[model samples]
Target: AEAGRFFCTAGRGLEPFLAREGLTLGRVRRVFSPKVDCVSGKVFFRAAARPGELRKLRSGERLFLLLKKHSPLPVSRNRGKMLQEIKSLVIEEPKYWLDIISVWRKLHGHEGETDDVSQENALALKRKSEEETNTTSKRQKTEQVRAVVSEECQVEAGETCVAPERTSNQECWIESKTSSEFPPKGSGETPSANEKLGFSFRVSCRCSGAIAKILTSQEIGRAIGITLVKQCGWRADLRDPDLEIFVHLNDIQSVVGIPLFRLPLANREYIKTAGLRSTVAWAMASLAEISAGSLVLDPMCGLGTILLEAAKEWPEACYWGSDISDLQLEGADGNIRTAGLMDKIELLKSSVKALPLPSESFDTVISDIPFGKKFKTTNDAQLLPDALQEMERVLRVGGTLVLLLSQELRRCVDGLTKCAGGDAAEASADSDSGAAPAQASSVDGNSSSLAQGGGESVLSRRFGSLVPEGVYAVSLGKTDAFIHKYRKVSAPGQK
Candidate 1:
């Protein structure tokens, strides 16, 4: 029941949503980033009265149990003294660290457990990180690497990654590894550059900016690893760590933590062809204001990730998803079949600009428009009004329309013109988690304000009669996006 301050690494622009999840913790606050990488936002909060409520968060990319935070860490050009101080910081509160670990074990005891298909696959994914893999496999080489490659690997309670021990019986192995031995903080985590953890553990130090000029990440990791072994009785296991301790140092502050999971909190492994981050997908659906027995539609469903996410979260609804690409439709079909939700979801092949369904048939429509480098077009700005008009046409009176688009595209709304044809096949990727978009119907007798004091904004002015309910900025890797929620006021001139 003791309160704990936890740190979560969130996608840029998501800190506000994460902190507002009604976490039983004390007030959740944002941490300043040095802006080295696209590292935009960070937040920390103390949880006690309802620490269990932390599990309610879907926007946090990865969770870290904050062991300690050294704000305004004394930095020095003298590497030796700086290393010494950080080393001491590692073992400062051994008992408290152990207690935190215990809490972590309890809180996530069912981690890697999914109610949907593929629990084993999810667990397998969580059991290792790039830092844990001994050699890169052919499959892994082709896969897109995550923003942060954690050198710290995690294992289940009983499972262990056995490998030849790299350390002697020495209590502290103070190896002075060069920066080359460790990846940069932007790339990922630090120490025993080659040490694999099985029953053992590893220390990861993410050092950036001015801190790197004086101390290498490995130096910081080693300082912590050596002290952890000498004072805290933790074993070293880089390849298979029972515990992966993370220490991040920058111009702003130094943070030390233990990862609560091996994967992002929003990560869902039930479907492999998913476009857009699962967290983002969940947000878009939340803004739909879905109610039981309501009909929901995703016109540019891509691999059906958004619909899949919505169906799983709001099962009582009849879900329909359509896309123009045969290849994409096939992929979505497979994903839907694999998730075993065929009964609740319906998939069709149709263009977003001209949906096959009749007008005013569905209760809600949510879409993640194609934009940016991943899915680009010559005149993407020119495509919005047409697709949006089609979406409005099919939406029943007073229905909710949630759109996810790039901030760049949103800004280009002023010079909009209707383009012939539907969105390109490239427009099939998107994700979101929201203000419960599809909660009790916002389309009832009166519309629900997306936020307490929400009013007409961006999409409302450029398009038809869709009134802007709420809009939230979201960070998708290098791309900046927004989730827009709207309710039809009078079906575009019905008034």
Candidate 2:
């Protein structure tokens, strides 16, 4: 049960959130990349710890146990320089490299057994990355290519006693070949590269960055692979590699690691259909901070991803999710049934703009609003406002509203303004005066929109709308989204 340092990658803005969760799971060491979109952290944990806990992490995309770090190296336009540096590092510390790979193998076992690599899923990963980038020219070159070594090659190892006859036969064949064909490194004896020399195993390199023009990643990968085979007498298994090395180079440095999991950890069992990513769903749920017995609802639930995630965290909470589409509701129902949370959840076929529920009933509402891209819509832009109004009506005073939205945020706040009963005059005056106009509540306890002074949009008025407690802007590769946490103000001025 020895502890090891590891790193986890998360959506750009949610690194802090993920880091906090990592702290709960283990001792978090560092959360780096403050300026860049890079959101990653290192954690220390026991090698014997259940990986299921890592899988439980909803916000992390990939996790890796640290092997070796080469920090602050000079940027090399020449691919050979970088390859030579990596080669020297590997050749100098071959034993350390072997030990790290061995320990990773021992802990995770053969990735082939648990790693779920399907044609469909792999393609999906590529497509998701492409979508995140949203730039076909750049994406086509980088994200689309899946780097894998082919199975047909091998590196020649010295003959053993058991293979005496074959050894003798190949020995004659070996004598005819020049020693310079594959020269041993660090002996100061320089040898030229030969094309005809066959290896016992094949190596593939996949290169990236400005240096890609000089050499491909696959070419660099092969060079390192060749060096390793020569130094350690290791045989390559490219098709189902005994060891798989990933080398990623940027303008700054190269990150190299042996993957412990074949697939990203976000591929949870409960995810039947894709909608909100489990990580984002988990972030929204965490920000909501719902209690065990709180009444939670997802009015725009599609496939119940958000509710399901919440249910996992707060099993005792009363969960209700409704979708405008019957087909989507059916899908959500199946997922709920598969999760064995039928007793813990309620599914309704209802629109977000008008839920078939009593006013101020839900203690908390969590939802991933339709950006009109994933789900088809007639009025793509109007959904957010209408949904906000309906949600505010159903959510009780001081209730939390956790929303994952991609666009039309201004309109969303505008809808919340009308829902709070704030009128155009008050909204305008609130904007011009740089002060919130006095709010007047109706007999039913709803605030009136009208206030003295300039006529501004309701979005301009503060306390007149739902009180925003937290806002997280999430950058998921090519996609941009936001998670907003709001507390319904207690019946206008009553608070």
Candidate 3:
């Protein structure tokens, strides 16, 4: 029979990821099992069969497979025998002379006969035995020749040799074979040398069990011709480090060196700052082209986390953060100081409804508004509308606004914006007293109305024609858990 095919399955939520990684539907012939997460109700794909052509797989190959529902379940039973078989096939069978002899004995028969018949039979048996022995020897020789040819082909093609080592352990066999051909010792060489040259050294440790420790800086420095001096030591920056090495220490054996380009994570210091949750910063940064020297404004700046991250990411930016609470401002100031970014940021205590800066003062506005019953607010329904208007007022024409709003507030904001002139036309016009009145009909061909009687006549007149159009409703739970970005567009003539 032909050799069995290799099967692989995708991790949960990794089907699209696998496709992106170039895994086509046709490549996966069979799937054997699923990895089900009982708690999360998530399912992962798994391969049904061990790959016979293991050398073909890349380090991060995305494989697909189908599983037979009633396929033999994996168990401890016959495990030893199966492992022994694989070992014999991959490593011990350089020549199959002994196996050939065993087959020959099985083909012949044991019997008794009279003296005359016995003599005749003995002669026949002798001839038969010689023929069988010669045939078997030739077959063995042929296999040996093929094995050598295959080895050469693998080396020339840069294919891995997957011969087993220490019959009982699978991981040990793979590591032994890999190390024999491409040892980690001279991994510091340039890519060209690595591809062309051959090294004699091999990894001594077994590749079994959990990875314990990582390689020390001293070991890595030694490999790369750098001396590690603890006293006059260099403090390496992980972000742009030249080399990273991992040292794994086994309970029973000495430490081993693993060279890598990326370093292991040391801690979550960046993620755990006072007001600047890493997730929130990441969300805000994704909304716009935040570059060095850009202007960033956070109106409802609690703890200044967004500003801190913006300063770090866009070091050339003028970061402005403001909060209504003095206590929050104090905390934000302390955080900014601790980050060593005081020079890069400007902090102020101000109301979101009435920012101290002039109109169109910032290139981008990003904020996470307060929410829930526990959150304190000046006015329940008016809070979001007022903050959004302020955000529109401060952001430059065409600048982006990324907001984190509660489901209830998001609905209210959307309602007001949809009903209020669709774009920032009126808002922009109000910023300049020289601008003309809004057109009687909006871009959407809807008739506009001028409502009167609010204390803030400027805002009332600006949004009066649009607020009656429709109620904007946003369902927080229904909305995808992601940052929402909106661009500010000038109304006609206001541009």
Number of the predicted model whose TM-score against the real structure is largest: 2
Model 2's alpha-carbon lDDT is: 0.57
Ranking of all candidate structures by their lDDT, best first: 1, 2, 3
The TM-score measured for candidate 2 stands at 0.68
For model 1, residues 433-491, the per-residue Cα lDDT tens digits are 22113112111223223223332233333344555566677878787887767676566
Cα lDDT of all candidates, in order? Answer: 0.60, 0.57, 0.41
Point out the higher-scoring one by TM-score: 1 or 3: 1
Cα lDDT of candidate 1 equals 0.60
lDDT by residue (tens digit), candidate 3, 285-367: 54455776678898988888777766765688788899988888888888788888889888888899899998887888888
Model 2 lDDT tens row, 48-137:
354555566677766666554555335577555766765654554434644565567566754455332223223333443454447563
Give each model a TM-score. 0.66, 0.68, 0.39
On lDDT, the candidate that comes out on top is 1
Q: Whole-model lDDT for model 3 versus the true structure? A: 0.41
